[model samples]
Target: MNARTADAPAANPTSAPAGTLLHELSSSPIAESLRRELLKRWPSTPDRVREISRYALLAPGKTLRPLLLVASADAVGGSYDGVLPAAMAVEYLHVATLIHDDVIDDDELRRGQRSVHAHYGMADAIVTGDFLILTMFTSLAECVERGVPAAAVLEAVRVLAEAGADVCRGQTKEAELTSDPSSPIADYETVISLKTGALFRGVCRAGAILGGAGPDHTEAVTRFAEHLGLAFQMYDDLLPYLWEPGTTGKPNTSDAGNLRPTFPVLLGYESAGRGDRERFTEALSGRIPAAEAYERLRELLESTGALHRARARAETEAALAREQLAGLPSSEGVGLLAAVAELSINRDR
Candidate 1:
């Protein structure tokens, strides 16, 4: 491990009580309500499939995407009942991505437990992910039954479809970049935007649409969520170095183990001088022991100031996200979303 930067600001930003609020938002009445609805609406047959799918879906999580969807609706004066199904739809899609991501990365842990693939084998995990994808659309269809207009449901479907495809594209690009670990920062930005930002924009846009927002407000929240997504991923990349497996709920070295070119890796390589640059290459290419490589890379990331630079960029993106919130109407929902933008940069996990 590297020494903590004495000059760095406290890890948790003062602008938002991110960790506490995440717990509050996840366990709030709305979240519990979603849980009940999920169990109620879940398919009843094929006991094994239902059981396996529930393992991941019902697992404890921040449920950030669902909260974002619900908050966007509330910001526009929309009711929870009308948007409940869309909330489910987004969570379904989110969980599927997590499961598939773990499979691809060969990660064993998720949310502090054995990952779906590690627990159930690859075949079951793959099919369970597909089942969740099908359920995302089925949940969308339920929105119509909940009194959302058919056209609105259709539009939400279209938005989520595009977002899902973009995530695939982003993952593909990320895999390609692993071969060229020193890829420029701009290319990394493109990948995160497609992978993470697209879904954030889609859910917020769909929530705005279903909540009766006009063109301008929809655009504003979409922009807000996109920036928030960018900052979220930046902070996420910092987590492995900043926190441990117990705190992050996943192996800290998973990214390095898989040879994934994460933000910190790229930034450090760019900023390092001759000696540190050569060491960074050794770590990335596995020329050294796993434990040594992990520690050396962390030290290099800190010494080269890559960690500081990444924190600054995350703060900038969070600020940009908050700026877009001004374009939205004032409400408690907007406040929650604004806090979320702060949380994007401030969170520890």
Candidate 2:
């Protein structure tokens, strides 16, 4: 909500279209495939557990991680059959993370509906998330049954396990920052690199390995994922500050409400003039009431050019991600992957 600066580009209609296409691609095949895989390999007997598991698992998530995994396989001329189990496993893993995230954030809504924890109670939600993670490993085991080599499957398992560890570390660091708001910029980067970027890099690497990609192509996809993940998460952090809460399908004030130091807030802090910085810090410390605090943040971001600079950083990451696609062969698969990088910056929600 800055003054319409010449530096700020108009909302891109093309980016929305790319998002739409990506949405369509993420659903249909991935959803149907995952549904079958989960049903086949589901490891629950309690009727209630099954019901809540389906409730959380079948929610309208983007399935972006699975899209990358399956699409990477396609890009290498590998049949979906070889990677279908791994693809389903990645989808389950991502959904598991979302359920746990909502609980950690104490978020009320997800995908425009009541969050699993909100509707089902905390214990049930926790169990549901754990079940999904359990099923993820089961699905990974099925990958070998689907003709994936044992060595490749083992490596993919190692990558995913490491990423899971990284996510936990990231969350721990984020907690530390939330409690003490003076965290450095480098701390934010490290937290994000583990929490968000690790999964992106791991899944893409897992996909490439499953697809039998050469070492060079696998490395290329890894870099592509790293760039895209940082930009995607930063854009997510910017959404509440830039647009309405409903626009992003979550509570807008959650970060400020929790006093979390997001990238934009931290950037705004660095860029603000001395007086504005003091005012912003007081706002963060809750000297200002909630509603007034948002106003102050908006003013600081606008006058100090922090939001614009954050947007520019995200665009740079997207550009770098697109460049990584050059190492892959030309195909519709590669094109959609490239379009995803474009969609990352253009996305409004």
Candidate 3:
């Protein structure tokens, strides 16, 4: 669906549209409760760290990771309540990474506002990120205390740790390529997959595992999230070139000005624009079950056409992900899960 539609309640606010997945899933009671729990977990000791962390973590976001957890639980016939702690853990970890990412990138803004480092200074921001990471571990410990098996908690932590490493590697790779105009598309994909896809995969897999889904189902969910996350990063990269600062509610063109090898830069402006259109077309080609929603999504992405080829690759990956879920049991949550994949492919911000 279009970004606005995706963000808004369906045509009927009282009842969700048929196949209008993620609308309520993201706003589910379990997800909301988990968000509250996470907010409580932020370090409250020193006023400075607490303030910086709160500002950074409380920014407006879709809270997609927790939604994935709750949705996966429902898909497996499990109670979303059972996985609330784990879901919060995932979100805490994500915020931790974002905090560190801002510091590393020297980003001046986030979510249309000054970044923590910019507003609070780099030292405080770095400590804030560290506190969040530690809090994530504590949250995971709470999950275990709540009767989730030690194995499940451990596995989730492993995945999160690996994802963190992948993010670091991706950042390093991106740094290396920033000044090099001839970077290969494959390299860019690798970076995006490692940096962005890794955490998305971890979130889905952790959700499935906590939901008690079998290994195969967890893998399927992970694959779906991975592809969707890559598409998210690609689309995010394109935003800098296509949107004005206030229009996107965030600063634009940092990548372009920094000489980063974004899709538009790599493919050349015209080719990249066309590629985005083609990808949007492919995403809406009815090759997947969520094609109708994908059409709405296509309309959103086609406005930019700045990362079409990367988007096309994401479409292929998303199609494969849908195929992977064919063998899983059907549930209302599955539709929401699929919708999340579609949304990721076409999200505007």
Candidate 4:
């Protein structure tokens, strides 16, 4: 990670002369709206918790999960306004998990800045995370008030709760695995899928439900979200090794101290390198055939073939997601969904 200016904006694909998957999905209005909403619900009970919550929630991030919710809603031709609460809820839930995750990982930094625990102390960070988790439920209650249908709200809550549990499980597994140096790649991936993919799946499911899709559509969206989430995490796995200063918003060698089960470390330098290439090739080779943007995504992954295998797995999942959406009505939101799938796998930061 490179030292970036404190107020520097997250890397944008075009402005930075780097290609990231999120470029096509960027929506300032949507992101701003989400921030405002999250701020409105910042912990108000305890002043200390409020401050801690603000620091964590207001941190710089791409807001990918919310974007996914909004895009998924759009894919079904639903109004963004209608889905805003759910989107916010998903983001809040995600932030809550991050707060807890930082504590568990004992990570000192996040998004190139001190993590909540580092800035506010561990006890306060835990309280802050708990507050955020409860606030997410409150947000969900508000969704019910907004006429999103009780069932839909409940479904989202259920997915979120299950995901939360899965994340905890993943964390436990990781803790055990990391203690021993012999953790297998498959084991690492399993933890990632549960820890990371679960929330992503929830994001998609919430969107599909809010969009008023049928059972089949919901199932398909779930599949798409699961694969997309896996891809997203796979990309994240690569970041710890490949991150650059000013580009990744953190120290280039930040993960070196952690000694976690990252792709490069697990596969070793040579085999990991070859795996990335082969995975990307398989990902785009009709294994999970997608539509128009698939080729563009494939090209992007291939170009960055240094991490091709991880990228390819992500692409394959995105491809599967695209296929899941095929039967749904075509709309601009759908296009956004497709773009988001590409973005999740191809982002540089």
Candidate 5:
């Protein structure tokens, strides 16, 4: 979803149609209650970590992951009250990853504010990230303390840990690919699956497990979230190229400037004519100005229908996510969950 600052100008009226799923979700009592509980549950800590945590955690968060977890629980006829701990713990894990991600990407801002590392320092950012991860465990333990079944909490923890490991593995793979233009498309897809899809699948499964869903139902939700997550990151990869500066809360051409092998980039190279392929590779090599390179690559993508191909693939994944929702019973929560899946691609930033 697009990030908007309090004072940022309204949409350009020229960008792609922005979806209302996030707006609709934010207005729901389910998401509203989750936001209130999150704010209340935030920990008091040393001034530095508290400030950093507050800035990152309480930013204009969509709370999509937490919402998904709670809804998944409700979809299976579980109690939302019982699933709150899982939902909060998932937020802890997600926010911690965001902190670490900005540090790794050397990004200067987040959600329209200075990044933790930029506002604080690398050391403070690292420590604050670790503190948030520790809180994830606290939130998980709270589930059992709150009278959720011990066995269910244990299963959820196992899945969360596995997903966390996959996240790290995916980050490592991405770092390895940063300089190698010849890196196969396999590497990019694997990275997206591990880095993005892993957490999405894990949280859904964790919620289902909390709801006492059987293995079959849990598996269905897990698969559904996997495709949804991949669609999310793929759209995220496209946003830097598609969005105007400030629309996405970061430099629009940073991805191209950094020469990363994003989905569109790979497709553009494969589909372009021979001469355009050479220019496309040159633009991606960072040997020229990022702005010029960004425009050139975008042109190549459009000419070769690479943009259309990539968008179609993302739409397909999103549709697959919707298909998986059929096993879930009809409810307001289910309806919201379906809308979120649609939001994965229809977003403007």
Candidate 6:
């Protein structure tokens, strides 16, 4: 599925294409309600923080995290009426990360537009990110007002708060690994798990808790989310090699420019001969221009079969994600979750 903002309804979900399925899921009444609540909770204001936040929150992209939260709740027989605030909370947390991440990575674009830092200056972006971080907790707290147990809301807060900390540690670890080009595949796995998988697992587990699911089902969904997140990050690393910025919605050279040791680059380097290794190291160190590094890495990744290997790993993770679904009862939400697993590896943007 592509990361298009506009949501469309599906006439026949069973027979619809993957993109349509995504649009259908995103346009569901519950999802619409979440959108309304988001707009209502954070209405237009003259304050710069509020203005920037409104832009960031309503940006053109797939609302995947919140959708996952709500869908997980539905899968376990929970109604949206009780889970909307929590869903909003996850999305706020996600956008906050994106804002801070753009600044840290020096990325100029996000969701097909100028990144928060690039468009709004670094100081404002940082402050806006902090505001959103605090806002996420308050949003989660509103779950109790919607009839969710205070205990469940508190637990969800703990889960997401830890997940946020994990993201920071992962970012730190990634920065450290950049100096060691030969960091093992296991290290890459660990980084992505903490950076990407942690929040995914948090949202799914929190959703299960809000839905009143038993421990077994909650564990299963958490595992599913973790594996899916890993696959998502793997595929995300491949997009620059497979498509242009116009298609991917972000600059294709951001990873190379930032000297990120993405999975594809690492795999290609590991399988490469001495000559290829030197070239890759030079490209990684920004000795070459970003566009050149991007092209060179793509060629090397293709030649060394690293691209194929990375894809295979993503497929394996997607399969693992699907396997966890068996623990949950059959429902529309479960089916949507399975489709999301499929989307992780197959998405173009």
Best by TM-score: 6
- lDDT string for model 2 (298-328, tens) is 7777887888888899988988887887757
Report the C-alpha lDDT of model 5 over 1-349, residue by residue, as the tens digit.
Answer: 1111122112111223454555666766777788888788766666878778877888776798998888777667677778788888898889899889888878787877788899999999999889988888778877887677999999999999899889999988887777444467778889999999899988888988887788787887888899998888888878876777677887777777777778877777776677887887788777899889888878888887877888888888888887787766535446656767777887754
TM-score-superior candidate, 4 or 6: 6
lDDT (C-alpha, whole model) for all candidates: 0.81, 0.75, 0.65, 0.66, 0.78, 0.83
RMSD of 5: 5.6
Candidate 3 TM-score, true structure as reference: 0.78
Q: Name every residue pair that clashes in candidate 2.
A: none
Against the true structure, candidate 2 has what lDDT?
0.75
**Prediction-by-prediction clash tally:** 0, 0, 3, 12, 0, 0
| Candidate 5 wrongly placed segments (more than 4 Å) | 1-17, 43-46, 179-182
Best by lDDT: 6
Tell me each candidate's TM-score: 0.91, 0.88, 0.78, 0.78, 0.90, 0.93
Q: How do the residues 104-160 of candidate 3 rate in per-residue lDDT, one tens digit apiece?
A: 767787877888889888888889888877877777677767677788878888877
How far residue 284's Cα lies from its native spot in candidate 5, in Å, is 2.8
Candidate 5 — which pairs collide? none
Q: Considering lDDT, which of the candidate structures 1 and 6 is the better prediction for this target?
A: 6
Q: Lowest-scoring 10 consecutive residues by lDDT in candidate 1?
A: 1-10
Candidate 2 Cα misplacement greater than 4 A, ranges:
1-46, 179-182, 286-289
Cα error, residue 159 of model 6, in Å, equals 0.5
For candidate 4, what is the TM-score?
0.78
**Tens digit per residue, CA lDDT, model 4, 23-66:** 43344456556666667866555577877777777787777888
